[model samples]
Target: MRPSASVAALLLALIVPAAALAQAAPCDGGSVFEDRNGNGRRDAGEPGLQGQRVSDGERIVVSDAQGRYRLPLRDNRSQFLIKPAGYRLANRASGLPDYWLNVRLQAGPALKYGGMPVATSCRDYGLIPERRKAAGDLDVLVFADPQTKTATDVDYYRRDIVEPLLADRLAGRRVADLGLSLGDITHDDLSLYPKLNAVTASLEVPWLHAPGNHDLDFDATRDEDSLLSFRHVYGPDTFAWEEAQANFVVLDDVVYQPGSKADYIGGLRPDQFAFLESYLAGVSRQRLLVLAMHIPLFDAAPGRETFRRADRERLFGLLKDFPNLLVLSGHSHTQRHVFHDAASGWQGAKPLHEYNVGAACGAFWSGVKDAQGIPDTTMSDGTPNGYARLSVRADAGYGLRWFPARQSDSDKVANPYLRLYLPKVLRRGSYPSRGVFANVYMGREDSRVEYRLDDGDWKPMRRVEQPDPAVLAENARDDETERLRGYDRAATATPSAHLWNAPLPTDAAAGEHKVEVRVFDPWQGEQRMSASYRLLDTAQD
Candidate 1:
């Protein structure tokens, strides 16, 4: 909802002086007032929300007893409310939660596409009553790279990805009370914001967003203006919110330098580092800190630094005091888990866990189409296009389960967690160098994976840092195909971090046999999943 004239005038008065002062002057904002009528205005009888947390995407401040807050803005900042438990944000015109206010005061060169206007005052977020929740047992849905570039891709997202999640996440009871979209929300198309917002609104939860490289404004000439459209729509590019026992920080780690077109780099800006330092100082060391960003904190592609190392080391230093921490990112379109300890620049008691989540619109909606007319956009790492369900316990422990996109109406795999690939025809005693492969989508480096052929004893599988053959074959098909109809081709297959291989047992009987593969999750010990594949014997045939 747009602000009323009176509200806008009040905000203007609060902002004009700050803008008139030194550009770097500490810009502060208005109060967190209660909207008695659900309107985005301060009507009579409505009082301020006192002692609530407010931030300028950097340092946080608490509202006084009068519900007034002052933010020390350093750049093009967006003010956001750390929505206290039991309070939910009022819906905006585009159906996004009204938890953020764009307070863009500094201006840059005008572009073909518009940028944020001068701000006088930051808007106050209106809240309604909600079932108060703690930082306890909570389920949150995480979608990486829902990078819809066109209306059709958006349609595929709604049909293939959103529908199933809506049913699964909303079924029986709403265990998933929160959702997070790990950026690339669109593929450089700012116009698609409304469409993306509309579909995601169906999830029926206040969703948080982090900006990706693709979300940058190509026309902007400076880094600060790169996310003008994004910030205008999704509020702060970086902000923090508190859950029961966790502090969730969504950061805009994609730094864009505009020229012919915006070139992007992955790393936190100086202000982000300063903000994190200040924010971390007040946070309890025991609380779980989950930092979600569009780009990963570590380089995934070989010989290429996806994220800057110095920035990561600085971030690690700030996080040293926090024993319980998790980093999440979603730009590689591949699924893997990375742990950082002292050796990796983290000086924490336990290694920091970061889930480089798979993309929702896997491989940018490429590859062949399914019967449902949706692209079979499997990731280059062989992980299916899916979302993550994260369960954070009251004790600060967490579990993440990868949910693959529903294949088709007739799909009936009892254990659909892992993908097992077996040899089509193996000679009775011939051992192939690479036997069978199991792409445990959520598998970690230390995960216990075992396989048994037919009724033989379960033998452990070796964790191999290699690309999944299935994805390699899929990539080959795109390269070999005569005609491809998608907007883009699938990404080249990269070495998967969660894959396991086992040589074929040379002593197996010459007949049809089943290969059962099991994965015992390392972090989540209770989660044990299995999938089976049919193996054929060439000798018998």
Candidate 2:
């Protein structure tokens, strides 16, 4: 039999020191209760919830039969709830889920961006019960590398990215169940966190954040204190959450090495590993396990490793038992899909899929201004600034779709998934050396792409390793002009992972020929676009 609430309170008071009774005590905790009255607080007759999971960054604890939990507090660490599947947390003034309590250091090192502000203890965590729905697909909104540097950038993010989604939700369109930002939430300016949070919270979904290299406190002497500001604003740097379709884990993979030649390296800490081992031991393998971070697990350069190899091996070993798994990362502004096999130390049943999502502020928000006074911000790989929608099925399989920040109204081919570049005029009988290029934004190497000329039989397009002509053209425009295009020039073109080419057919009798391109997207299925090019009669000239 469990002790009564009053008796439990008395026991806790007796066991805990008097000095630790205050809100900022070294050992602070309270009850987790069902908010039956719909108020944010626990009232009379409100029953305490047992078996709720809570964490103090490093260790996880469960509530007793009386719905009570206690944990030793660490300065600058957060106490956050691991939200269960069928309950919802009360919302704070910012409209974000009130799932965390920030604990600040009484006397800490001064940071360039102010460290965490003083906070009172969150004694009671009030969770409202939610009706259980029939198991179905789960949709999540994913944003990576917002990397906003200034207040102006935050405004652009609000107007360009947040508003449209908010409007869709307001208009009764299907919206995501939750949101996740893979990291680089700001560009070294931690002060913009609140503003960014406010804009994101307007959507009214709980948002989970992973800390990026840019989100660090450079002034901190050691790696442990690098995310002081981030922890204060967002909760734990590494944590987990549960949903009907999937189990999500967000990790702070950036390991700050103060005064080293490289400021930071992508890796996990010992404490994070301990937490993961503990949490994953009890996780159900029937659902998909998703690990979200700011750094890609694969190396960026051939011989040089971006993420620590040893840590990757250890992580892969831990995840080997989970059959359904996905890894989401940001940091490379360009987007691509990676499959981990034996060569990369993955010993899973199948190749592990890692989607390196494109940045929200494409190329550091650099490019010419649009009519709306926002930067073009196209990524170097020809993928536009955007976010991704991830859908997880009941079977634990997942699908993804990329959404560009804005679509070009003037595009001859209005397809959102593809952009094509073709010459305006070509000689009627010219050698078929000139080819039409296609940039499939969400394309993979295995993706099937083909083109047809004037309703002719389709010809397969060959995947190529070359810079995107569209972005190359933009680079040429910036280089040729003496005047500044915008606050900063567009990113220089890099060899795209998703580009394809097929020669245009010039032998056919032509005035204006319609070239249709179609790609079989892995998730979105078939997508098609059409463009026209005129044939020139040189004799007339």
Most TM-score-accurate candidate: 2
lDDT per residue for candidate 2 within 332-407, as digits (tens), equals 9999999999999999999999999999998898999989999998999999998998999989989998888854
How close is every model to the real structure, measured as TM-score?
Answer: 0.87, 0.92
- lDDT, each prediction: 0.78, 0.87
State how far residue 65 of model 1 sits from its true place (Å).
1.5
On a 0 to 100 scale, what is the lDDT of residue 271 in model 1? 76
Deviation in angstroms for 69 in model 2?
1.6
Model 1 is weakest, by summed lDDT over 10 consecutive residues, at: 526-535
User: Candidate 1, 92: how far from true, in Å?
Assistant: 1.1
